[model samples]
Target: MDNNIFGYDHNNTWVHQLTGTSKLLFFILVSIIAMISYDVRFITLVLILSLIILYQSQIKWSQVRLIVKLILIFACLNLITVYIFSPGHGAYLYGTQHIILHLGYFTLTKEQLFYELNLALKYLVTVPISLVFLITTNPSEFSSSLNHIGVSYRLSYAVSLALRYIPDVQRDYQEISMAQQARGYELSKKGKFMTRIKGVSQILIPLILSSLDKIQVISQAMELRRFGKNKKRTWYMARKFSRNDYLTIVLAILIVLLGVWFMKIDGGRFFNPFK
Candidate 1:
């Protein structure tokens, strides 16, 4: 198996050794904890726990750079949206005496500021948890684990195929691009924005054609193997859970319980100033 950013690492370790199903269960459990509330403390704790898992996965931080960049962009976009769409309640929450800064006759208030702050914190809690899962979990392991949980092996393999294809698709695109350039296409860095857009548009047709060809080849290969003919199929990457897996699950469940308890006590979502 060629190891890409999303592929499973085969070298024996605590994370690598865990059964695919157990890891999927753990991922879902953590995601539920992360999404169920916008409470600062709970989210913070979940984020911390997720970070610990990421560290334990043993995949280098450099390997997760793409996911990290995406998370940063998402977090920033969330903050911007909250700041702009924040309900105008500035004076009521922030205790700022009504001295409004006129923005061309429209005044901004302190309540909005507080609301934005709350929203920012909510993103801080949610985004990291998501990023941690995306970076730490191996896609092939995730799929095999899902199958172990009684999902159809066909479906699980489809999921695995999608993960496995990302890098292949990227590589294919690069190859196609170079081929296009060789044939008098000016798609290099020197092109204007519109020109580059047009150049990319030209690339898309060939990319789509190549992708369809690849899919056909894969389908034919699967047909030859008589896939889905059996109720269950053995997986190359699947295994049973171990003691470490059980311990990880138990700890995650405990954290979720604590998060639920806190939400019950301290009012759930901190994204609004009125809350």
Candidate 2:
């Protein structure tokens, strides 16, 4: 089916074979550790590890290329804004001012540049893993895993529906765009930027109507099936955790512990090499 857009496909890869619960747990643990630590060494290590896992995932670069580009743009904007607003933030944080260059109200210091580098590394590390979690986990299986972790079945199923809807929405948009194009509408990059935006905006009205209709159909079907009538339900896609799953989670925990250890050793989250 539309696996790429929805972020799930059946594959024989080891990452795909891991139980959804274990993968979810690992993602959460690692994400928390990444967000909490500012130690450059620790962040770099996690970024490297995440890249390795991403390579092992065997996800097609084409599927995520646009997203990667967007994240890169955003990360660059973030660094620029942070530096623009507080040019000496890094110096202030590290309690050192080794200036690299000085402008009117902005002075680029080694510490500030290093701080920004770590911030960029954090984004590079976390974004790919977040994408991996989305691209790898099966919605139904993930829903079941959420329930297994004591989440409400209704909430879990809602999450599953949201994930399933992404591809549907994308497919609808493409179909509508093609139909419009066949009717002599120009929505591509050949037109002026604003013109293209206007053309694309025209698609949204029909898309919304179609989405509403689909929602009604799905709601009726669920009602006829008496979905959510019971407090609990069995899942056909539920899977038992395997040895690899256990090992994966254990490794994630160990990495988080290592980050914590680095924080302790550094006496803070910021690793000051200048010191």
Candidate 3:
């Protein structure tokens, strides 16, 4: 398995040892809680816990640096866009405004900054868990785990195929790019931006044709095996829940409960430090 396929680390780690079902359940639960709540304190705690789990997974920074950079860039863009469009959104939410800096029509408020901070924390907390899950999970095992959790076997298999194909797509792109470069095609930094775009676009047609051919082959193979002919099927790669899986699930549930409790205590999702 290539470790670079969508940032998946093909290494042995404690996280990798856990059942795919458990990991998926944990991710789903955390994502739900993180997305639903707007409490800074709770989100910060989740961010810390997620980071700890990511660190414990023993995934190297180098493996995920590109993805992390992209996420950070998106986060910054989101923050800037939110502030630009709704500069007083935080004040509206918290019902108070303390101007930090005045800029004619756009005044920077502490409330807005804090709101954006929580929003950024939400991204920081959720994105790493998603990446870790992708990095640690085996596609076959993940599919089986999904089926174990009562998802339709067809859907599960589709998910598995998508995961399996990501690396193939990347490999195809690289091979095609190299082949083109060997033929004196310039798709490098030396090319002008539009020229590079046009050059890359040329790769897409061949890539798509190759992808379609591979898909047809795969479909034929699956058809020959009579895949999805039955409602239920056994999975050779499926894993059973272990004691650690139980513990991990329990901890995730506790965290969710704690988040809810925080929301109740704070009288809403926003933990207004200003008040």
Candidate 4:
């Protein structure tokens, strides 16, 4: 389990055994459903479901701590930005404003807070499923799955290459950061927040260069092999769908239907409690 980067780490769990296509489709459908609906009940259920799926995968916090922290920081910034731009938007959506606090220009309301909660949950709803897909699915298998689903092999292979390259780029970043720290630049908690941010920024230039070099090397290798010379290519890593994969896909479909039903009952995706 790589602590610093999020990548496919082979685990002996049932989740890992499921075909990449099912997981990929689930990720895409769940993300779309979660984003389209704003009802807190539906969002919370999906969020909890996603967490349960993640837990069943047997992933550890230590393996995902860095990415989780980065996501949380972004989530916080998003929430703050929403409040700053549309403080009253929530009240307007739910059609009521139960005042909670009066911070001059920003009069805190129960509706606003509830709206924010739903927004936060919506943002979080897809995270675990995404992690499950990214961590459990093999890039080669994923590409094959995409091709199996009618995507061009070339396009699917490009996606696979990007997925395969992500961890390498992250590894390069880690090495560069360590070297910078060895030379007395602090990227760790030992330094101030801004200083650490600056240290990270300084490493980006070389990281990009390293990534470009890798791209060139890979392109040359592919060209030498005459890759994409044919219209369609066969996949050696293709996986057959199993009972579990079928059931998992069914469950994902059921979840999407549930979200749609909730939207219908809520009379347009946003649940109105004030009514």
Candidate 5:
């Protein structure tokens, strides 16, 4: 199935070969660094590296089509909203106002443009790695890794189920959609946009009902098995760290350290070219 959800895509690439724990740690550390700094060179490097990792994972554009569109929409809206709300905030940050355009009350300046450039790069830096992490990490294995690292097995398993259920839910939606199509409702491209939208809503109610029923069944099964009775539990999906895992983790740490160094060198979060 061409998965329309963010779930593990089974493949035998180098990115997929690393243990879930390593990817988890690397994502966390790298996200921290990316979130903290506004250094263009550093952020660009991170963005490039993230894109390289995305390519290495061999993830198809089709599997990510919906999510990529959504993120782009959100990112663009956010950038526009930021500019609308804070037209002069960037010039304020850089302590200089080099006007480039006259947009009535909103005067465009190099500082504001640069700020937005950094912000846009921030999105690029984080989104690819985030997508790769979601698409490549095996949910059950990641849960086991979490518990192995001192997380409660109960919570970890919940996370696993949540991740696992996403694809299941998407699958269910597709099936329901197909059923609807058979009964004279088509969500195809030929239909009007509003008609397609209405058809979608028609499927949502059944999908939600199915999901709730599944959740109840799962909970009852876990209770019958006396899950979470013990404070500690062993993981069947537990993965051992390999040399690649160690190497990847070290690289993540190095990247974080490099971000810190860039912060110190830049003397602040904003790498002001208009200084």
Candidate 6:
């Protein structure tokens, strides 16, 4: 669990030391900004903020490469989809434009390319901000913040446990795969793709069995501790709101307000760059 993907490093940094509520608010505000505007300028502004937060978090790019690459792949797919299917047939709905390229089967329109760029920028804004929140904000901190914001302790704890279980499930799957391999069950196939496919199915039974066993253990532990007996509980990692926290919260609120303003300019939905 020490090297689990979702595990946090408790260091004293501007971003890390900020209250969890501040970070959550920031993430939500940025998400709204990302969702509300498809204009390249607006999306780029949001991405700049996201990049600043990413830098502040002090997380190594290498540590987050896999997730970043996955996001980029999705972004590229989105760009392709929007370019192919953008509404209004790419006739410079908002700006002057001309054809950029032409293929035998498809004509590349200026509006379509700009629309794709907007979609790509939207992913650049949202994904890094989301990754920052996921990597920097510990689950316990998040749960505690949620409790402070009037969530029931039971619900908060359940949410925390659900987050904790993601890495656990990943670890369990790996362990089960190794155990099966040691017992001469082949999961890494050498030849036919179908054989590899069939080999992978061997892992499911053990993984499910181990997950069930883990759930049982957790349930028994909760029962022993009389988990639901108290309507209130104390958190070991509760956050105290400080001046910096207040400032961050204010910034988040401002960002959300700005998003609302932009949404109004967009007529209450995404600002389509093509229009």
The best candidate by TM-score is: 5
Give the Cα error of residue 181 in candidate 5, in Å.
1.7
Residue by residue across 79-192, what tens digits does model 4's lDDT show?
999999889998899888889998866889999898999888977887798888988999999998888888999999999999999889888988999999999998999799
lDDT of 3 by residue, 46-133 (tens): 8888888889888877667778899999999999999999999999999999999988557999999999988888888898789789
Instruction: Please list all clashing residue pairs in model 5, or write none if there are none.
Output: none
Q: What would you estimate as the lDDT of candidate 3?
A: 0.88
Which candidate model has the greater TM-score, 2 or 3?
2
lDDT of 4 at 141: 95
Taking the tens digit of each residue's C-alpha lDDT, what string does model 5 give over 1-275?
Answer: 65566688989999898888998889989998998999999999999999999999999887888888898899899999999999998999999999999887699999999999989888878889988988998898889878767788899999999999988988998899999999999799989999999999999999999999999999999999999899888777777889999999999999999999999998988798876
> In model 5, where do residues sit more than 4 Å from their true spots?
3-5
What TM-score would each prediction reach against the true structure? 0.76, 0.94, 0.93, 0.93, 0.96, 0.79
lDDT by residue (tens digit), candidate 2, 56-82: 888887667768898999999999999
lDDT of 4: 0.89
- Give a tens-digit lDDT track for model 6, residues 1-275: 34545445565678888877778877877787677676566667778888888887888765576677887888788666766565434555545456677653357767766666666677678877787777777889888888888889889888888877877777777787778778776666554687656656877787888889998999899999999897888999886789988898788777777767877787754455544
Mark the regions of model 2 whose C-alpha exceeds 4 Å error after superposition: 1-6
**Cα lDDT, model 6, residue 232:** 88
**Residue-pair clashes per candidate:** 5, 0, 1, 0, 0, 0
Question: Would you list the rank order by lDDT, best first?
Answer: 5, 4, 3, 2, 6, 1
Model 6 TM-score?
A: 0.79
Whole-model alpha-carbon lDDT for candidate 2: 0.87
Cα deviation in Å at residue 142, candidate 3? 0.8
